[model samples]
Structure formats: C-alpha cells, structure tokens
Target: MKEIRALAFDVFGTVVDWRASIIREGESLGRRKGLSVNWAAFADAWRAGYQPSMERVRRGEIPWTNLDGLHRALLEELLEKFGIEGLDEAEKDHLNKVWHRLAPWPDVPEGLARLRERYVLATLSNGNVSLLVEMAKRASLPWDLILSAELVRRYKPDPEVYLMAPRLLDLEPQEVMMVAAHPDDLRAAAEVGLATALVRRPLEFGPGRSFRIPESGFDLVAGDFVELAQRLLGREATAGPRRRGAPRPPSPG
Candidate 1:
C-alpha cells in the first residue's frame, strides 16, 4: 500500500521449484552413475543442510563462503551419507550446479512479466551472483537485476541482506516489497522497514509436508506469483478511481 516501485523475490522456493528440480536432477545423476538411491530423501537432506550451513557462517564458525561453496560441502557429505559413490569430479560439479538449472514455478515467467510492467523485479536471495545469474538465464526469469547475499557476504534473515535491496535500488525500504514463501524471511525484511509479501508455497518442502500459513503480519499474502501480481496491480488500479487513460491490471491467465 506504500506505492511499491520494485519487488525483490526469494528465488529458491518462491520462484523456482528447487526440491522437485533437485530430485529430478539427482535421479538423472543416479541413473548415469548406476547408483540406487532415494533421491527425494537426498534432495531433502541437501536442502536441510542449507540453513545450518548458513548459520555456521553467521556464527563465524567458518570464513565467508558463498552458497555454492556451502552447497558443495553439503553435497560431499550427502554422497557419503547416502552411500553413493563413483562420481568423477566433473559429474559431481554438474550435480552441484543443479541449483542453477532449477525449473521456475509455472506462474513465474508470466507473473513476473506482469509485475515488471510497473515494478522493477530483482532477485534478493542467498545464492551467489553467478548462481542467480545462471538460474535467471536458464529459467528466463526476467529479473531486472540479481542482488544476492554474496554481494554483501551474508545470508538471509540477516538485516544487512534485506537492507541491501533498498540501498542498491536507490529506493526507500517501503518502496521495495520483499516477496518470499517463507515467513521468517519476510519478517526479517519487515524488521528492516521493507514492505513484505508472503507468497504461499505449500509444496516448497515437497508434497505431504504441512505448511502453516501465517494469520497476519504481512502486507500481502498470495498463493503464487500470478496472484501476487494481480493483488499488487489490482490495488494500484483501484487506488483512487481510474483515470480515463490509466492502465488496468492484466486479466488472470
């Protein structure tokens, strides 16, 4: 409601289906390597390591390392934990870069396009610059820019990470909305005076996993990116009675 000029999104679960993408890629790797493994569990374990790995950095238990480095470290552990073997260095590297090739949620491409008509869209994620860039290119994500925690050498839930968006985009915190599927991420943005929008991603952790929607504490809540665009643009359209030449929100696709 504060006239948002830009939208900064959490890429992993909000825009792209990371779990499914990882599982798909892992299955492919398993086949090529002739390894029998539960890829779903493997994907979950890899993702499970994400926060703890970041926390290690936050606690200064490790020196500054990008998400790629953290993920590669986790991948090595997971390979051994799951009894996987015989992958050459190149194969392992390709599997590690699977994060770069994640498929976007079905609504993302057009939804972001719709939102971009009025708002500058950027990725505000924990992923490294190269990783985010490759993902945007591979998925045709249509981001106006990629702003990562790697730029500031920090991870999400860190105030500096959220603050980076407003600083880099030359906008007030309120003028940039942080769009994420996770409440903690949005809450952190809100604490830093940025507007927040929660886009529910019930399947982010995969099917049958219980996801609780917050009852309040966000500027907006949407089921997906398309709905987010509709809500934001719709509000703008009706803000003060449309002028004769004013643009209307795109009809639902």
Candidate 2:
C-alpha cells in the first residue's frame, strides 16, 4: 500500500449514517402530517427496497438510471404501502430530496477536514454525482472531487466502478485506497489491486438495524474517519526522514 495516494470513500453508510438520518427526517415529516407512523420502520423498509430496485436496472428489467431516480420510484411505492397520502407533488419531490440532505456521522466532517489537509479526497459512491454534490454542500463535506458510479454507470461491488476511480485520477489501482464501511466494497477493490481501508460505523444502520462488517482482507482498519486520518499520517510520517515542515506527497491527480 506504499504507493497508495488518493483515498476514495464510499459515501452512504461509510461517510454519512443514512439509515438513522432518514429515520429522523421521516419522523419529523410524519409528525407534521399527523400520521403516527413508525418512522424507523418506514425508513428501513424504504431502504430495504434499495437493492432489489437497483437489481432491476442491472438485470435490464428496466432502463438505466441514477440512484436518485431509483430512490424516487421506491419512495413512491413505500408511501402508498405505508398509507402515507395527501402529499402534493412538490412535497413528494422535497421528500425525495431528503436523501441529499442526510447529515454526516458525527465524526465525519471534522475527520475528513483533517484528512483533506494532506490528501486528495474524492467520493467514490454509488450515489449519483448530482446527489453526492448536493449532499456535500448540504452537509459541508470537504470533498476535493465527486466521483460517482453515476459517471461510470455501474454500482459498488462491480470492478468497473472500483477501477474507474484510478483511471479518472490518472493513477494505478494500487495508488488509490478504497475507504468504505462495507467489506464487500473493499473486497471488490482489492480484487482489482486497489489498497483497502475499513472505517467501522457499527451504528450506521441505527441501533437495531442489522448490518455488520465482516473482518476481511483490508490493508487498514479504523474506528472512524478521524482515526483514518491519524493512521494515514502515522504511515506517511514513518515512511522515511523528511525535511522539517516539508509538504507530504500527494496522490495522482
């Protein structure tokens, strides 16, 4: 992993806690509608539709589309299933945008800010570029570039998406570190010669939400983004003697 330079992160559960933030947003919106809905259940069920929804497109059962497009379709189905009605098109549109408004995991911004000082940080998310860009602005995420599956038209766990980043950044796969909360994503990255870093977010799915990160062939493991930055610095700092206060090396592009 010595040649690793750019650190590309998976955005949803990895950088921001999507499930919990969605629940909070749903609860607030439900309260306004006086709908006494189980917001947590609503959030989970909506997200549960996520994978099957994408597979439809991947299998060519439907047309190719961005995550936001896919999400809006699932959101409409869920609204009807949950008996959530009486919303105007405008309100529904706003609700669809909720994914764009998700707050970061508590440590994310501060940690990324610190890490950005030394590395060229880019988002390598399944989320669409526009969606990721909006989320970055909404949450004040300090991403140097937004590199999404939308650009590659492929999703996580696909070698295309994993390999696209290094090409876009003009580097070898080994010079790019794939940072994700999901072991499956990093596993895909590793299969293609990329370095891997796992940053745990045990509560990413919320307290009772059932997602787990299996131990895997990761190059590094971190408690959170802050720890990730600290460990990277430690690795670089120990690489060799350097002129005092000299700049650290940068990743390609």
Candidate 3:
C-alpha cells in the first residue's frame, strides 16, 4: 500500500453524478422549449448510447472519436427518438456540453482534497480531455492532472488504457490505485496489476435500479468517496484484508 503513489479515478458516475446532472440540464432545456419529456429517461437514454458508441471505436468499426463527439451524435439521435424538437444548432450544442458541467458527488471535493494531500490524483475516464478539464473547473474538482481515454486514444476495460496511466506517471502499475464506483472498472484495472478500490453509488442509475456492491476481490470497498479517502489515508479501518478471488454478485441492497 505504501508503494501506491497515485490514484486514477473513473470520473463519470464515480466522481460526478452524471445521471442527475444530465437530467437537471435536460429538464431545464425541456422547460424552455415547452416540451414535456421524461428528463430522467432522457438522461438514461443519452447515457445508454455511451457504451455502444464507444464499442464501435473499441471494435475498430469506426475511427477514434472523443467522448464529446460521440455524446453529440448520441444526443441528436436521442432527441429525435424522444420526439424532442425546436432545439437549434446552437441550443443543441449548448445542451451537448451538459457533460462539461456535471456536479461532483457531495463527498468528492472534500475527499479528493484529503487524498490529494497524500498522492497525485487524476481522472482516468473515457470522457475526452477537454470535457474533463471543463468539468473540473465547473465543479471545483481538484485534480492534479487530466488523464483520459482521449489522451491514449483508447477507452477503458482496454489493457492499454489501464496501462497508460502508470506509464504517464513513470510508476509501476501496482503503484497506482484505480478508484471507481463500478466493479467492472476495478476488475479490469486489477487484472493489469493496478490496485482496485470500489466506491459504491447505489443510486448511480436512478432510485429504483439495482446496483450490487462487490462481495470480495477488490483491495478496498467504501460507501462513498469520503470513506474511500479515510480508508486510503488510514484514518478509518475497514473490515480487514479481503481474499483475492472471483467477485461474488452482491445481494439486493
């Protein structure tokens, strides 16, 4: 654990509440346009296109496209599908940048402030670099640097993306811990020798969606980022060491 010199974070749902941010912005747009829509569903629908859009790039079906571009394309499709209209090019463009203004989870700024005192902190998200930079500024997030899929031209769950962070920091993979709300992200990082920490966000999808907490295999699991900071900084104690093995599906929350 002492060898860990840096923490690479998964930003979207891990740090910022993308669902809430997008829904808020979407609802604002709907009100202005006098269009009634399920803003939550719209937010979900926009996010739904995220993975599949990235998959195209991952599979070589399309050339490299940053998250910003992919998000715009997805938003356009969602608007048409949701039957939303009257948004002009400028309005569409402004709405597309909603991702840039995502608010961090309540614990993020304080937690990251504490964590930054101990180690270098940076974003390890699929979001493009510019988007992340804007988000950090808008949300007052304190990141030492911005490292994203755009920097390496590869999305996460890819070994190359996980490997890129350590290389950029001039450290071994084990010297950097990947902090995220998603187990799949942590598992992928762990597979490549980076330490893994899970920060559970039960309502990440929405109020009713089921999100299982990891039963084992991760290096640390905490209820939120502040707890994560406490565990990482040795301020609070966790249950104990976890046995490394396959992750058990979490029971219903």
Candidate 4:
C-alpha cells in the first residue's frame, strides 16, 4: 500500500453534525417566528431532498446549480408543505444559510488539529465553495483546502468529484485517502482508485438509528476524527499546541 499523502473528507454528516445543528437552528428560528413546527422532521425533510435535487442536475433535467441553490429551492417547497409562512426573502435567505453555520462534532476540532500536524486535510464535499468556506470559518475547521463538487460542477459518487482531490494535490489516487461516514461514498472513491476510510457517524440521522460497520475493504475505520488520527499517527492524538516553529497549513483558496 502507498503512504497516504493527504486526506479528503465528506463534510456534511462526516465532519459536521449537520442534522443536529440544523434542528437546533430550526428550533431557534421557530421560536423567533412563533411558528409551530416539528423541526426534527423539517430538518430531515430538507436533507432528504438533497440527493434527489442533485440527481435532477446530474440527469440534465436542470442546468448546473450549486448546493446552496438546490437547498433554497427545496426550502421553498418545505416551507409551503409545512405550513410555514410570513418569512420575507431576507429571513428565508438567512434560514437557508443555516448550512453555513453547522457546528462540528465534539471530536472534530481537536482531532483535525492533531491530524494537521502530519497531513494535508481537505473537504471533498458536494457543498459549494462559499458555503464550505463560511462553515469552516464559523466552526474553526482546519482544512488545508476546500475541494468541492462546485469546483468540478459535479456531485459526489461521481468519478470526477472523487478524482478532483488527487488532481488538485498533484498526487496519485492511492496517495489521497477519502474519509467519509457513508459506505456508498467510500465505495465510489475506492472504485476510482483512492484509499478509503469509514468514520462511523451513528447519530447522523438522529437517535435510534441502526448503523452497521462494513466488515472489510476499507484502509481504516474509526469512531471519530480523534480515533482516526490515533490510528493513522500510531499514537494518542490530543488537542495540544503545535510544535515550535511548525508552519501552519496554507489557507484554502
């Protein structure tokens, strides 16, 4: 096996707790507007539309649209379906931008900091660049780069999207590991020659969801980012300060 030179991650469920963050933000929005809604279901519905919306683009039913645009379209439908009303355009825009404010899992910041010591970390997500940038800034996610489907204008599970990371980094496919929580994403990356790691996110859909780990075919599987670092670095990973004079990774363009 080749030594992994960089790690490309799936952002939504894997790096950030999008479901919980959306629910929390939705609840707050509900309170401010005094709207009676089941935010949990709302969050789920919004996310459920994600793949189908992207498929519309992939199938040429619609022209290429970024994730934010797709999300906004879905939000409009959801608002009407859930009987949510009276929100102006500005308020609707802010609510749609909730994806930009998602908080990372508790283990992420520390684990990513530890991993940054030895590897280039980048996001391999369907999210548009601006959304990824704002999310990173808000969460303090230490990504060396933000490579997204928006860059290639194709969503994940597409070979082009998986291949973009290695091409951008000037590395062979084997040298860039794809870390994600979804087996389908990993499988797609593996088919395209990248190394794969499964990071289990059991609560990604909320509580009482059944999650079964894949028994084989991955280079690594860890419970979270911290464990991922420990497995890769072969030591206990901590959220400690970097070594003196260690240069910070370059900011994503």
Instruction: Compare the candidates by TM-score and give the number of the best one.
Output: 1
How high is the CA lDDT of each candidate model? Answer: 0.90, 0.85, 0.87, 0.91
Off by over 4 Å in 1: 240-253
Q: Which stretches of candidate 3 lie over 4 Å from their true place?
A: 235-253
lDDT of 2 by residue, 174-235 (tens): 87899998888888889988999999988876776556667667999999988998998888
For model 2, the superposed segments whose C-alpha errors exceed 4 Å read 208-212, 241-253
Query: TM-score of model 1 relative to the true fold?
Result: 0.94
Q: List the residue pairs that clash in candidate 2.
A: none
TM-score of each: 0.94, 0.92, 0.91, 0.92
Candidate 4 segments exceeding 4 Å error: 235-253
- Look at candidate 1 and tell me the lDDT of residue 211: 74
Q: Highest lDDT, which number? A: 4
Question: What is the alpha-carbon lDDT of model 4 when measured against the actual structure?
Answer: 0.91
Stretch of 10 with least lDDT, candidate 4: 234-243
> What TM-score does structure 2 among the candidates reach?
0.92
CA lDDT of 130 in candidate 3? 89
Higher-TM-score candidate of 1 and 4? 1
Give the alpha carbon lDDT tens digit for every residue of 19-85 in model 3.
Answer: 9998888888878899999999999888889999999999999999999999999988988999999
